[model samples]
Target: MVRPDGSIRVGTATVAGVLAGTVLAGCGTVGGSPAGKETSSTREQDTKAVRSAYGKTAEQDTARVTLRVQTSADGTSMTASGRGTVDLRDGDSVMTLSAQGGRVEQRVVDQVLYQKLPRSEVPGGKPWIRIDLQKAAERRAVGGQSVNDPVQAAAFARAIDGKDVTREGTSEVGEVNTTHYRVAVDVAELPDGATLRRQLGPTLPMDVWLDGDGRIRRQQIDMTLKAPAEDAATDRASSPPRPAKVRTVMEFSDFGTDVEAKAPPPRQVTDLTGTALERGQTQN
Candidate 1:
């Protein structure tokens, strides 16, 4: 199945719109300075600051992360939250989340995602389901998008345009004093920007908080899903409704922390890649 963002769904129990590879509860509004116009030079400076911050964050190689995802659709809304550690260089991560009155666990290593689900779902009562995102990507799954781990999700800041960045003054994330900025993500500049633009629209607004060291302390993206064109002009009763509105917030701390994400024991894992791919083909 396709996620709201068009990426292939990996497991049955997803928290909010994430968790297929990356994921949330405890999501709430964050207060910050109101957006203010900036001079051209200031805009350039802001862009440089964000880019440089991204570089510094990458250099740290590992960090502790807290995630909150809020979604609303068809008059229903839900929130999910989680915490985890990520190894930026190796693309490995381990996370545990609270959602739908249950606990969900996920691990990502070397492009493979392992999800630990309830005991009943597995054929042999295996606890973990394995999905190869690389295989899914190679298959050109219908919604066509890349799944990013928490660390890589921050890369979205790299797509910012100088003209769309506004310095929002200061705020504190956790105990760290930070500079808050409102940014417009130039979706076209991302690797999958073309597909995202077709699905999510031209530009996405974002709020980013950076510490004195220029590392991102907090970032949030509130996304509104566009209705399908074919369904747009049809009667609401006849056409399907649009997907949920998803808001994802990520907070980072403990940079340079050690993160070790190893694969689940083979006996406990059920390789679901082939079955998932077949099911996807049938749906498509």
Candidate 2:
């Protein structure tokens, strides 16, 4: 679909756009101190434990994910859902997203994104559009935020272990027992956090649930955003922002699951790398 810049970005960039848009939906408020006070040493221990668990989870290499995103802007609201599996190491992934009564499937392999669209919407009647993320990067057409990297998305929980991470006790998520935590995600550490921080703020509140093994079971972010201006080519300075609110939740399962991704048959593909770059479209 077309971005605010009037350019198309399919696959991970599209998902990233929606997700990044979700997180950037609004500025964050100062977090209230957690209910229980902790000694500095205890906080350090908890943070270390959480970070270690995230590291262990990342080493698992793959997982299945289900997500929901809801956004409200200009007095209008919408919701979208997605299901996918991703290779945490290679960044290969396959995902399907549903929104407004439509579904779209996407696959990423060898740093290329393949999107399946209605035949009428694609050139040459090809049902799939191929965009080379590597080519896009080479042309500086992507913001290098790792937003399109499934690996990055999977490791997003790592942002929760900042100094302020608070253990909120234990709870059940699905059939698993998990420890609940709350923190202001450290945007500075995220690959694209600097940009997000500039657009939204330095931190965003997040709630996470971790299984005993330290793997994330569920995570949520609720934010209010100053929506970027609609002019496709205008910079933030030239366009007034819109007020909006967004919330996103994601759950993980089947860690280390096998995730397969293959490039679409060339005959059914329309390469859009050149056109996307020519339009000066950049994804964050």
Candidate 3:
């Protein structure tokens, strides 16, 4: 796939849509009361209650989440599928990212320590690059953080705290009862240069749906991004441009318990200089 600036351009596929949905959930509002002391107090209590419920629910069940990402604009599209396993008690987790066509990236994490094994080209295929887990863990402490659905879920919870939140009623999502909450969040509240707001603009609205336990089960969001002007010289050098509007929707399901995930055996690393490896040179 096309690596833009050394980072994979998560294509405009279903998975990209989901990521966009997660990010958009951190912005704006939907017909909610104006922000005031009463509104703030109620929202604080509600958010605390929600977080408490989430903690309890998480303690009771294990989450095996699958993320589908699709990113598209202009005409190009890219899709990715990933799975995440989180053990809330110890904050240990494992996440694997793979292109449906074959490429696979795996990460094994235990709290502050993590290991990014390698980017395997295909199932049982050659390794293109290997990342030391110890090094990855250190880097994460310095600033690098993996982007996953569970992380996004946590961020959403944080965003709702002490903000202007309003209940939008109940709805059924995949046979589960969900209560919808709308909150207006300012992008400024997030760290500067957050990719979501920088690429998608700063002032959009999000609608979030929570199950009875207050866990976010679904979300709908709208975002407006500034893109290059048609008359710009280069695609990357465009001036303050027209805004592109996007809508995203996401749903989470199949909550279970005591899930155990295992990392695949390590693969032999290879150089990309066109040399074919001898048969017995493979590593387990």
Cα-based lDDT at residue 50, candidate 1: 76
How does each model score on lDDT?
0.63, 0.61, 0.42
Ranking by TM-score: 1, 2, 3
lDDT of 3 at 261: 38
lDDT of 1 by residue, 22-108 (tens): 232222335533445456787788888876776677688878877666768888977766678876555567778665676767776
Point to the candidate with the largest lDDT: 1
lDDT of residue 249 for candidate 3:
50
Give the per-residue lDDT of model 3 (tens digit) for 1-284.
31111111111111112222233223333333344535656767666755454455455455544444454555554554555554534434444555436434433323222223335322235543323222322322111122222333344455454455666656676667766676554554443325445544554466657777776565455556555234343444654334554544544556664445344344544322111112112200
TM-score of 2: 0.75
Estimated TM-score for each candidate: 0.80, 0.75, 0.54
Candidate with more favorable, higher lDDT: 1 or 3: 1
Give the C-alpha miss distance for residue 175 in model 2, angstroms. 1.1
